[model samples]
Target: MTGTELVIDGVTLTAGAHCLVEDVSLTARPGEVIGLVGPNGSGKSSLLRAVYRALRPATGRVGVDGADAWSLPVRQLARTVAAVVQESGAEFDLSVREVVAMGRTPHKRLLDGDTAEDAELIRSALAVVDATDLAHRSFDRLSGGERQRVLIARALVQQPSLLVLDEPTNHLDIRHQLDVLGTLRRLSATVLVALHDLNLAAYYCDRLYVMRDGKVTASGPPAEVLTPHLLARVYGVASEVIVHPRTGAPQVTFLPGAPALATRVEADPSAS
Candidate 1:
């Protein structure tokens, strides 16, 4: 897949009289991985909900591949965009394979059965998330991290041009978190993911959008957007953004409970 171009133009989201997201705009070029970073209740999830069509924008448009997302048919939209959100409900009495197979529903008739390609995709997706052994086990019986991996596999099998994920590593351990984000970094599909971990976001994302108080306060490459001053302003925490010696990716080091000790730290371009 060449991936899809995503554009969120002048979007505003509201719940009753309360505004959740206001005048937000962003874009993801085809095959680019975009990261949304924010503190809790900063409207990251709400903004994502609009992109995935779970919530309608009160004022702006969500575009995928030059077409308005809300204007597309439900099945058509599903075929173009696949999302793995945080509040995945219980999947009762279904095997992991069965749950992953649900991704094929958009491409198949109600009476149709799994094809060879479908089976292969399912197998590959499971293996990608290191969940191949759990394919035969019950989905509901799995732990939170296992379930999160399975859900990601499900989204992968959908073969959409755009993938929207909210905290894909929420319940994962350190190893699994790196693996999942690494997998996303290698995908050809355009990815828009919300992350609370600044280090992971810095390493995985091609570009980052920093959100606060229902608005995008800063956005750019990881080196430009993840400054100590920005972190303190948006997240109310003191942090130092350092460049990794080997990989050269921005790494965040937080100063817990000591704002005075946290000074602006930028990666020195001259350092070898």
Candidate 2:
């Protein structure tokens, strides 16, 4: 599937009279993976909510392919943007396959049945997510990690031009987290994902958007954006920046309570 360019221009979000995010602007270029990262309650999720129309902006625009996103009908929008959110709740006892099949809803009519191609897509998604064995199990019985994998599989089956995910690696083991992110890196769809792990954001994302107190504090290539000074200023944590010898990505090493002592200890062999 081809990717769509996503632009959030001067977007401001609010809850009643309280502003959640202020004048945030960013972009996910076609076929690129952009990472959103900030401390909890920094308004990363709020901004994503506006992009997917779960919440409307007070003043600004969210556009896909250079057209206004909020102007499109829900079904039309769903067909182009697929999302996997952290709060994906369901009380029903649908089978895993059934849960994944729901992603195809936007492409089908009210009376249309699942075609062979649809079944194949479902199976392929399951396989890619390593959930093929759980396809017959009840979705409600799965663990949080299992449910996450299934939900991402569902998103993949939708095959949309843009993918928006919030904390997609929440509750995942290290291996599964890497696997899921690796899959995203290979996909053609433009991805706009919020992540809590700075290391993963650096390793997986093509670029990084650092948010702080409802503003775009920093944004650029991962190496350029993830600096010690910026991290200290925005995250309030002293860190040392290093380059990964293998991948050449920026790797952040946060200092402990005492920054000066931590540096000396790191340099001293006896501290190990």
Candidate 3:
């Protein structure tokens, strides 16, 4: 409710004759977190790529803050939309502070020096991701979780109205996963994240978009879209959907395909 709004209209992405995403249209409201979930090869990444301009839709339009995103200058777009992508290799071995400072590139003129304000913004971003302590560390030497946080800090330094993240929790431990998602939830910017963790998606997302094959299979609040029937039909998995005891959020527990007898193994008294 405090950042930019996204309006994707009739968006379609295709690779040669194969359609990746088709006729996908959705609005992401300011200060709202929307989760995109699907099985592998279901176009969740493809849809997000279109939103961030990594992949231009073969047809349709993506509008951010009421203007066509494609119509904006690339630099202007970069300033408005910050993305945390899956790519994490930095061959140049930049320091953490330097990597974060890169986020301010869009706001500065070519060959411009870093102003005091820019440095302050970088510090602030680092603080947001709790990475300030590692500011002087080599980015390449950090663990995967540390690197992920630094990248997020970099995106935060951009001060964009819209934030897009793809599998942001990858390689994170449970605690770090919660920390990262919690940080995203607290940001004022609009967020659209692709997640494979259904429980995390339900816990953090204000709305959900469930994709299958190459189209949106369901879109709504988590409680509405994450029902057992939908899970079975879309994911080919039988699941029990329940509300979280604390947050009252929809939680899913999948039932494996094997028979119940195989799933049940009584504890052995001798082993105990």
Candidate 4:
């Protein structure tokens, strides 16, 4: 099956009397990368949870490929949208390959045995994330970045139309960060990623959604949404927006406040 398109229409997620997300609506088209950006408590994770069906909306609807997301069977949804979340704890002693193979579960019968084709897919997915070298390694023994790559490979093996990733670059070093995002950019599937790094978001995302206090404050192409004013207002940090020399993407540099600026300039006369 082809990858799916995701649409959130007037969705509201409430917990007790508090609305964690309010009337949030967005569409992720096939083959597009949409970055979700917000402060720590700004509902970025909550909204993503709704997309992955971790939390159902209190009002409105989420649709996948023109069908209501809730109406799809759990197994079917698993095949359509694969996610890599922030939490990566697994209490099992499964090997990296075994963990990635679990992505094939939705495609198999209850007691179905793994086929040669399943093994091939698993290998291919591992290669995509550069985890093939660690295939036989125990997941628990791997470093945080390694484990994250394994989880991403598992998601890739699911062959979903839409991929949702939460802070995929969190534990990765600079090179791995670029490598992972670069891989996502080359994939055909639609991607909705929650990102804290505005520079990385600008580098990989086709468009961006800026959330503030559980509401979507602005959304558009990275160049348009990542303006100085928007960053200052939403993130409470003054930033300078510049165009990337090679890619023409928006590059953001946070402006240090008075104290840090004085220290830096005083330390080096040419720094300013």
Identify the leading candidate in terms of lDDT: 1
The superposed Cα distance between candidate 2 and the true structure at residue 60, in angstroms, equals 0.4
TM-score of every model versus the real structure: 0.96, 0.94, 0.91, 0.92
lDDT of 2 by residue, 152-250 (tens): 999998989999999999988998899899999999999999999999999999999999989999999998888777877787777887776666677
**Clash pairs of candidate 3?**
1-30, 1-31
TM-score of predicted structure 4: 0.92
- Ten contiguous residues with the weakest lDDT in model 2: 260-269
Residue pairs in collision within model 2:
none
Task: State which candidate, 2 or 4, has the greater TM-score.
Answer: 2
lDDT score for residue 234 of model 3: 86
| All models, RMSD in angstroms | 1.6, 3.3, 5.2, 4.4
What Cα-based lDDT does every candidate model obtain? Answer: 0.92, 0.90, 0.87, 0.87
Per residue, candidate 3 scores C-alpha lDDT tens digits across 34-76 of: 9999999899888888878989989999999899898899998
In order of listing, the candidates' clash counts read 0, 0, 2, 2
Measured by C-alpha RMSD in angstroms, how accurate is candidate 4? Answer: 4.4
Model 4 regions more than 4 Å off: 258-272
Q: How big is the positional error of residue 168 in model 4, measured in Å on the Cα after superposition?
A: 0.9
User: Order the candidates by lDDT, highest first — what do you get?
Assistant: 1, 2, 3, 4
TM match of model 1 to true structure: 0.96
Worst 10 residues of 3 by lDDT: 258-267
- Cα error, residue 180 of model 3, in Å, equals 1.3
